[model samples]
Target: MRSLIVSCNVTVDGFMAGLGNDLASLDFIVPDSEQENALAARFREVADTIVFGRQTFLDMEAYWTKVDSDMAAWINATPKVVLSTDSGADVSIWNNTTLAAGDGAERVRRLKASEGGGLVMFGGVQTIRSMIAADLVDEYWLKISPVAVGQGSSMFADLPERRSLTLRGAKGYPSGMLDVTYAK
Candidate 1:
């Protein structure tokens, strides 16, 4: 079975998006370091498919489409599965994306059962919450930044029950950002 990993950039206060749903704070915290590059490469190697919520998929599609970097190329080339209820969603703008409509957990479970590399999920808050509530996430790779936003959306909110995670590893960068990996 392929593992489902929730990879996200989070603030010190545990918020994924700051006031007004801004993620600009994350840009200042990302280090131009070899460790970060290696981490990205590792995730790319492990996951053949990238999963997203509808909004995230659309956002990434708009942003990454014009970029020329390796990350952009990889993201554009890799298969993407967007979980959405909108039957009319036009995913054609993205080269390799498909929209999955129906039960979110059931679709994700079916994806996990399929023969392939690991699946990586980037969230739009509600999607992450639903996955957590359904106990569908196998691992979490959180890049904890130094800044804290007083008010914002939390990545771990609305969980049905307390979920314990075993710390697999942690890497700290010069920029004060910590890349922590946890296993369920």
Candidate 2:
């Protein structure tokens, strides 16, 4: 079975996106450096597939497709699964992409069983919460930024119950971000 990993960047206060539901506030964190580049490369190496919520998928598609870089190439080539209810939306605009509708948790369960590599989820908040509520995540790879965004969408909000995770490892970056890994 494949491991379902929730990989995201969060503020010290546990928010994923800052106020106004934008990531501009986080621009100060995770500065562009060799370390950040290597971390991204590491994620591309470990995860064979990228999973996204509807909004994030759309947003990423719009943004990443325009950029010309190795990460863009990897993301464009990667097999992607978007959990969405909007059947009318065209997921084919990108290559190696599919839309999974109805019973998100069950679809994720089947995907995990059918695959061998890691399934890394980037979020729009609601989708991650759904997986958490269903108790379906296997690991969390969070980069905790030093600054707190006071108000924004939190990474672990409205979890159905307590989720106990063991600390797998942690590393600090010169950019003042703590890369932490936790497993269930």
Best by lDDT: 1
Off by more than 4 A, model 2: 19-28
lDDT (0-100) at residue 44 of candidate 2? 81
Per-model TM values vs. the true structure: 0.90, 0.88
lDDT of candidates 1 onward, in order: 0.83, 0.81
Q: Can you write out model 1's per-residue Cα lDDT over 32-125, one digit (the tens) per residue?
A: 4555575668778899999998888988888889977666777888999999887777788898888888777889999999999999998878
Screening candidate 1 with a backbone cut-off below 3 angstroms (N, C-alpha, C), the clashing residue pairs are none
Clashing pairs in 2: none
Question: What's model 2's overall lDDT?
Answer: 0.81
* 1-184 per-residue lDDT for model 2 (tens digits): 8989998888888888866457666663665355456556877878898898888898889978998776677788889999887766678888899999777788899999895688989877788888888888999988788887678878677866677889999988777888888998
Winner by TM-score: 1
State residue 151's C-alpha deviation in candidate 2, in Å: 2.1
